[model samples]
Target chain A: MGVTGRAKRGKTEGPILKKCSTGIKGLDEITGGGLPQGRPTLVCGGTGCGKTLLAMEFLLRGALNYGEPGVFMSFEEKPDELVQNYASLGFDLEGLVAQHRLVLEYVYIERSEIEETGEYDLEALFIRLGHAIDSIGAKRVVLDTVEALFSGFSNESILRAELRRLFRFLKSKGVTAIITGEQGERTLTRYGLEEYVADCVIFLNHTVSDQIATRHLRIIKYRGSSHGTNEYPFLIDQQGFSVMPITSLGLDHPAFTERISTGIPRLDTMLGGEGYFRGSSILVSGTAGTGKSSMAAHFVDGACSRGERCLYFAFEESQNQIIRNMRSIGIDLEQWVKKGLLRFHNTRPSLYGLEMHLVALHKEVERFDPAVVVVDPISNLVTAAAPKEVKAMLSRLIDYLKLKRITAFCTDLTSAGGGILEQTEVGVSSLMDAWLLLQNIEGSGERNRGLYILKARGIAHSNQIREFFLTDRGIALRDVYVGPGGVLTGTARIAQEARDAAASTLHRQEIERKQRELERKKKTVDAQIIALKTEYELEREELQQAVAQERLRDDVVMKESMEMARARQADAVPTTAGGKQGRGGRKR
Target chain B: MIAAEGKRVHNGDGEQWILRLYVAGQTPKCLTAFANLKKICEEHLAGQYRIEIIDLLVHPELAKGDQILALPTLVRKLPEPVKKIIGDLSNTEKVLVGLDIRPFK
Candidate 1:
């Protein structure tokens, strides 16, 4: 009796914010660290976009990962069929049920068999759901496509009213819920139920363009919190749907305190004093056929030689092709691949959406835990996405790499005649820590390749454009050579050399022409100087005559002043006394 | 054993008996009856009698399996079929009639 009273008090307190961990990878991030505890999140999507899978993953992960009991109310799928569908994904639904941690209720309603029983008020459904949830103490609830009730009943008004009431009832009871709805061709939800009664709405889209299907999920609205707004592409496989948030990681990753070599001595010299920080991003841009792949291969081999894992994602070459090609250049990728230190994921750039490629990259990176990640040519990825999308994906990739403290090397293929210094395909060149530009310069009737360090963020890098050659010994960089012209590319350097020679010949002709013009100007100045000197002497003689006339007038004035001064001295005595008396009277 | 007016005979040898149970109709109150007697008879007397099921609507004289105080009654007549049960055979003694038990003696 004592315990009974306390238990009653607990029940009246209602459900606290019950949280269900969505088993979906990266989904929790978009959900502001999972759906509001005990509140229903409406998941609406078109057919085959993994709406049900998402709901099931939420329930499964709740039971498996978080020790929270769950209830799945399926109106569309039978319990057995639902279990079978998730079996391939390694979710043991039956085991969870047997252990009493999960409950699944299959509500079968045949519309034809149903009579106009106005007395039925979904009381039976409430009883069934209530029993299932209470029986398992379920903290998570999933109503899989509850819209089936609309099919069973003809009255839309009653269905809407009841659905709202049901959501309110579940909320009042305090169960964290996920309610899935079908998506209409033009509407966010088939029944538009998602527009009402739910606290959150997520839209799942399966878009096919150019014969490639990609699944994208966007949080349409989340009340009381902030979430990522971009349409993040996800993958549906044996492990269920995994949402790859294109910008989940921000730019505030911890900088690596230690430095690591780039595996090439010359390349390392270009990166600061010796090497780059372990987790920094390196951008290598060049025109076609400038050995970008070779540089990446060298990095991969470098990481492998240090007994560290390296992941190479070659968008334009197969693993075997890359390994074989690199072997000829003395970069033995095959040996590293055999040692399990090197993992190669080579696929076409157009194989999937930008987000799908990112998800695949993320999955491999997570599984391998590699020290370095090499994208042979990230430029090819731009073709599959818009410039903005490519930027978002690359930002996410770089952020995730920094979080794992993994060095990332990305190669970009610039177009010919576009100049040596070109922006990256995604416009993320500013985000890179070290940027390297490779070009083919033509010099002395031959094309020589040059590599230069554009910017290294945190360290001093070699500014010299060093001459590099792909020989039998691998990538060897010759010392900085100051040739006739500036740094060279294969054909451009030779063209510049010829242009410089022609410029020198034209300079000599111009000097001789200037000397002849100077001689003519000097003779003209001599004649003008003699004419000006004669005019100067005549002007001086006229100025002297004027000066003599003014001097004669000054002599007559001085003689008159001397006679006046002698008369003033004879009357000086009496004048001085009179002047003193006048001064005293004026003062009084 | 002699046969006289109202005389009865007791035989040590097990012999087959004929019994009948009656009911007014398939009313809810009268439905428990035939099943009750058949179950008792099968358990006590297996392979001993050929039970005849009779309805009074067809033959009123064979208000058998017991005395007819209610719609459902029972009467036994073989081995002199023995006695009759009345009032829907709600009593156990009235059901012993088909087993040849004389409660009056």
Candidate 2:
């Protein structure tokens, strides 16, 4: 089916169904535009469900914003009471009346004073309403709790007939009207006035869940128009009624590639050396005392240091408490607050329902128009609503922040005992663009904080776990030190590092001893070679001297032998010893 | 109605009943209601009653004073405790009872 119409500001289209803007935040989008134009819409709810206020706001907004005159005919409250009630909400009803832009008609009825005698019609009511409308030339009308007529009159059939005529008369006069009724147990309204005002039906509900009052608005039906059927949570505070349409926003927010700092240089290094992407949702989850708030403070500090506005929502701590605590860690948040670059919104989770918290966050973000938003420990919000609801609210919030291209840094406190520190109980981890898991590495009789990037989309983040310390200076991330057991931290890492240093020293001493032993062995081998060379030289000299002595003796012997031979009648030829000559001849 | 009106004796200084009949215009129901109210006042109240006709169509703003919603509404203005009766006074017995005249009769 096609949409009946879309309400555009200051513009109209042809033939489908023309819409009137309700001039309410997040309401016009849900109603597909506004109530079917020039037709009476039935708004039914239980007492104190804001039906009267809704109708009054419609008429007031019509008069103020849409430049359309309005007439408010109240059957439940007096004009003075209404004016006073609306005055607190900053609506100038009396001023509007003075300007002839609005007319407030109070229909007072006392059943005890009236006696019904015979046949009659509610022509006076019609005339009164018509006169009020004509007096201002109103294009919008509000009959707040018109079903009160049922109690004041005895004839139901005539009242019903007249109500039908009243609606027709309103349509004929081209005045878009809102007719409120008290909710019935089964039917949409007590008097079944929905049957008469069939053009549109809106149901307001004020229900208490876990003792938290949440107001919701649902469009039951709209003739010739399509409207949001989901019950959008609405808030009625000083700003009046504001409906929050959870699924109204689509996933069409523009993506930004700009990166911002996470405040800690090492943490930024872990996140691909730059920080979170602009317009990204960052989740920093950890157990208690794991410095989740500190991480968020750093993010806010980073944004403010860059001269960008930051909105910090502290659920667990007050503004002064956070400021003082961060000051202890050497981060002066008060200066940022003083400079108007940082804003702290502190509220307890139990102060409102999940939707109310979302509305407040939305209001703050819109008012501040911050470049970065930080919610320190969103896990506290689980106490206000269910995990699923918290996730839904966070999803809408992240979507809103992303649409505005605001960097959102939210800290979540994971339950410690038996609860996985890696798992965010609210299950909002998947909704975040970057998730930093802070855990307590309990070992060596002490607990130490460890931080690791679980996920960082579109960036190459570090996979190593860095031991983080919350020191007096700031949060410091140490490089991972793997020991015999695992990644050691605190004194265990220190002890292991000390042991490694000692072992390296022993190794250096052992190498020095081996070098001395090798030097001694080389010297001894050199001395032995010198001694052997000297001994061998002496032996050779002695052998040569012996041969020389033998030779000299032999010569002396030959000379003596020759002289003997000469003396013994030896020939003139050189004589040799007979035995020597015979031996030489025999040897030859 | 005449017998009942004659049987009651009017008492007190505020006994004069000043009734105002509010109507948008001269419709049949308005005329019938005015006629019936006049006849009932003359019979039941005699000389102690007075009827005032207020056309809401002519003086529409005056309807807020009597809190008039239905046409041809009768309001007992002069009595100590004012009373209001709605609808055309077709049933004189009910109308007399509403006016607190010949109520038991």
Q: Which one wins on lDDT?
A: 2
Estimate, for each residue in A187-292, the C-alpha lDDT of model 2 and write its tens digit: 9998899889888899999888788888889999898877778888888988898888877777899999999999999988888899889999999998889998
Candidate 2 deviant stretches above 4 angstroms = A1-13, A352-356, A482-484, A498-588, B1-15, B45-48
- For every candidate, how close is chain A to the native chain A in TM-score? 0.75, 0.82
Supply the TM-score for candidate 2. Answer: 0.83
Q: List the residue pairs that clash in candidate 2.
A: none
Highest TM-score scorer: 2
Error of 1 at A348 (Å): 3.4
On a 0 to 1 DockQ scale, where is model 1?
0.02
* Every candidate's lDDT: 0.75, 0.88
